[model samples]
Target: MTTMKVTERVQGMGGPGRGGPFGSSMVGQKSMTFGPSAKRLFARLAPERVKVLAVLALAVASVALMSIAPKLLGTATDLIFEGLFGKQLPAGVSKEEAVERLRAAGDDRVADMLSSMNVLPGQGVDFGAVGTVLTVVLVLYVGSAVLGLTQGLLLNGVVQRTMLRMRAEVEDKIHRLPLSYFDKQPRGELLSRVTNDIDNVSQVLQQTMSQLLTSLLTVVGVLAMMFWISPALALIAIVTIPLTIAVTGAIMKRSQKQFIAQWRATGKLNAHVEEAFTGHALTKVFGRRREVERQFADQNEELFKAGFGAQFASGLIMPTMMFLGNLTYVVIAVVGGLRVASGTMSLGDVQAFIQYSRQFTQPLTQVASMVNLLQSGVASAERVFELLDASEEPADAPGSAASVSRGRVEFSHVSFRYEPEKPLIEDLSLVAEPGQTVAIVGPTGAGKTTLVNLIMRFYDLDSGHITLDGVDVSSMPRRSLRGQVGMVLQDTWLFHGTIRDNIAYGRPTASEEEILAAARATFVDRFVHSLPDGYDTVIDEEGSNVSAGEKQLITIARAFLSNPALLILDEATSSVDTRTELLVQQAMAALRSDRTSFVIAHRLSTIRDADLILVMEDGRIVEQGSHHGLLAAGGAYAALYQAQFAGPVVEEESLV
Candidate 1:
């Protein structure tokens, strides 16, 4: 496998293009409802259902424990208050007698306040009882903390595992998708779905899952406790809930659209940046830096507008919730105070009821605030789901295996098109006998590369059949067919690795001696010997440390190492200088011995010695013969040759 071939396999297909199958229209559309997306997201957690249930149970236990502590603290407050007030009463006097004595002295208000407290006439500050109540409250709080911590840890494990599986599925899906799918999609936008969107989903889950559950349970537990203390006060405290829901609902409706827009803008911005950076040198050469910058600014502005709108709208929830909560607090406080003065409720009960009211509003506030995160998460989830739901290529035929012996290939009335409306290659047929060299020459978009791509099965035919060794290529398992073919394209791709490692990439188990022999055969040994690290010289990510010709040589060396039965050279020597091109040609000549080869070349001189030379135009074979035979015939090949070497020739429409 050459480096370009490996890149093709990994990236699937398609380079930077206009619009993808998942186009801008899809991205720009508002996420009207997240119900289905949320359902699908939760379904991914089905494997972790037991852990999720445990988290819920822990949340319930923790909230229950914490809720009881406030009430117990209220009891402690009552004990201290009752004891302090009891000291003012006469010693050894019954509570009823003391109250009557106080009433007889025109102290009815004081007597009424005393009746509300569970006080002994002779006692002062019951320290032991207060200490016991304080100890139980402390234990409840500690237990709640421990449970919360345990649940947090468990939830993290569940999330990490879920994300791991999600990433793996995305990777597998990419490999299975057809090359045409990539043709419509931008690299940066696809990457955003894979990396940024999925990461956002994970973050949203981490931040909201446990907290939402705990808040909801706290609300339920606290509400029950409030009602248990005083039904009227409980009712008053819950009055704000409808208003809270209405406010949150209205804000979230607007913010959800903005969140969707924000992520879409993020994808577009990332796409622009990736495209700009990848072709930065070209942009500079063309002096289009200012244009690129202007485009970037436009996309950046779009992202900012969307992001600001989302955050600003969601930010309204908290302050609005706080205001409603304060209103409820004041109402409850006033009501509880009047009830206490009337001797209908004790001081302890009223204090506990007030604490429950705060607890109730707090969780409500939390649930309302988390709406932003939920919307963001669901928006990202929809993007990821779109990727996962993309159409995949047809599955390989069952029990399909190609057995190649002499490398005979035949294109029997083959027809193919990139788009249904545009016929690229139609009714194409050819045969390359075992060990024959066939050269394909054509203008751009004349189906030269497309011809070889069909043989490799990078694409499937629209009609007819391509057979290798008398077996239909479509019926063969793609891997089984691809394993026998070696490819070298004009555009060389070298990954970040040592020269030796790159040469041995196609066959990782190749011996060092085989690696050296392949490198030497490709004229790579001459260059390697001059470098400090020789065969171990590391290539940077961009392969910038090496010259363009050197990168091309390394890819040729990789093809040589693979020692394939069928060879493809797609303008493989286009990058080298004249002197180096001679060396590469000699190397390719040696490599082509006894192997069937397809060489697509723009340079006519390189294919003059080929057994068969085909001249293609408009996806059809205009001429085919030896160089001398075509030159003598004075046809399209002769015209192209004349234009290259002899002089300017009158160009016909077919030639153009």
Candidate 2:
């Protein structure tokens, strides 16, 4: 399978517009491989068979009831025709005689009475026999309809339950996968699996059971009656079977590839639309309106073409089978008519064969109409399970610790890279003594964020050793590694809730006192108090409720409340206003006094006072010393200091 060079996920579903304007190409990616597990899943659907069976039974009964009434009328017509023409029968007495005799002798009172009433000439009974026949027919009709309604209720319940379980299973699979899995997927495509794919499966499930059951039962029952009445005509009817099947099968086979194309095109299209919406602000600022629209139009055109092809192909089978159905009916009539005249079959027998001919074709046509749609649903099901099969991070063994001691960190000969031999960090080594502030400063994309990400175990290093209190972070569980490391990141993400909720999110179990303490220290409490609701105020999704500066402080409070021994502040104030920056600095001072902290900052002035300053370049530490000592050496550290620190410093002596 070929792979796309994906950067970020757009959407997580498989639907139209996956590659709308910003998504990566969905081509050359892996296709879902169906296997034994897929068959097992079908077996899991075994219990749902009962619902299908009920629906089929109801449908068969309805069709059979309609078939029976037609023949019963035909039978009464024969008895009257014979009695009036040449036998021992009274003139103008045939209708009453047909009704009274059949009701008493044949247990077909309803059929006879209906035949006595006029229904339609050259069809069935007339209206005169309506009362007696209708009473019983109404009961049968209503009963069958009631069963059909019940089947609908049962079918819906089964489909809904199956989709619910499948959705939960898909969710668990998504979170279980390693972080790299998301890099290869678009959020909209993945989202489609949960929302659109599952929804499509729901529609198929709603109809399949009833359709399968009714068609099979009615077809079998009708063919059986036809065979009993006259094997000759029934045998002739079977010849049209092969032709009907070939037509339907060809339609299905052709539609399969088109559907697969439709599915892929949809994923690509969604990827683009998701990207457009997600980076809408960037697009607006850059004035990329025409460019974005052109991109969208390109992806959408591909989706529309593929979708139209699949739907158009699948839709034709219905009419083709219908045309063939009429042809089959004509052949049955011509062949059956000769047999009746030649005394080879009785009039009633000929009548029965005609009814069965129509009944039998009903199923073949129904199955023809729905088979392509059925396969599409199964194709989607296959995709859902394929995702469930993706590789995931190993679950941590039970008994893994979730606690931390006094913050102490050490990285020994640490090295990492996204690609082999293209090192981002080369033999990087550093130490943050317990309760000391160590700052790492470097150019953009110089492995600064990568270092913090490694500490959190977001990605494993190629060759490196990071430890906390002499314990190897790698050998320990990821949960254990992350539990001991707290960070205030440069990019602050807020959820839809109160400012209080955002801070408390770090440690949901933290007490109100701890939360307030963390907030007060970070100066978040000050702004929150300025607002009408204080800590009770609600916020928008992603912290749209506050300024970027305030968002940073709220994040600081989150880190503080977690109270991890090791704190990494990566550009905490780089994007904030000067006013909030000072408040955050004071909060940092309070947080770092008793913790071992690694501060990675671009603003040289912010970290110059750190106990140790490490100048990094090309993944190597070019200089390391105290701020004044490095400045005295007139090296890289001195140059970086000259670039950023024009502000008045609180002298070391005054701070001490």
User: What TM-score against the true fold does each predicted structure earn?
Assistant: 0.93, 0.81
Best by TM-score: 1
Residue-wise C-alpha lDDT for candidate 2, range 49-95, written one tens digit per residue: 87656655666676666556545545555545433332322335555
Alpha-carbon local distance difference test for all models: 0.85, 0.71
lDDT of 1 by residue, 42-137 (tens): 799999999999988899999999999888988998898899889988789988888899899998877898887887898899899999999999
Range of the 10 consecutive residues with the lowest summed lDDT in candidate 2: 1-10
Q: What lDDT is reached at residue 195 by model 1?
A: 99
Query: How far in Å is the alpha carbon of 42 misplaced in model 2?
Result: 3.4
Question: How many clashing pairs does model 2 include?
Answer: 42
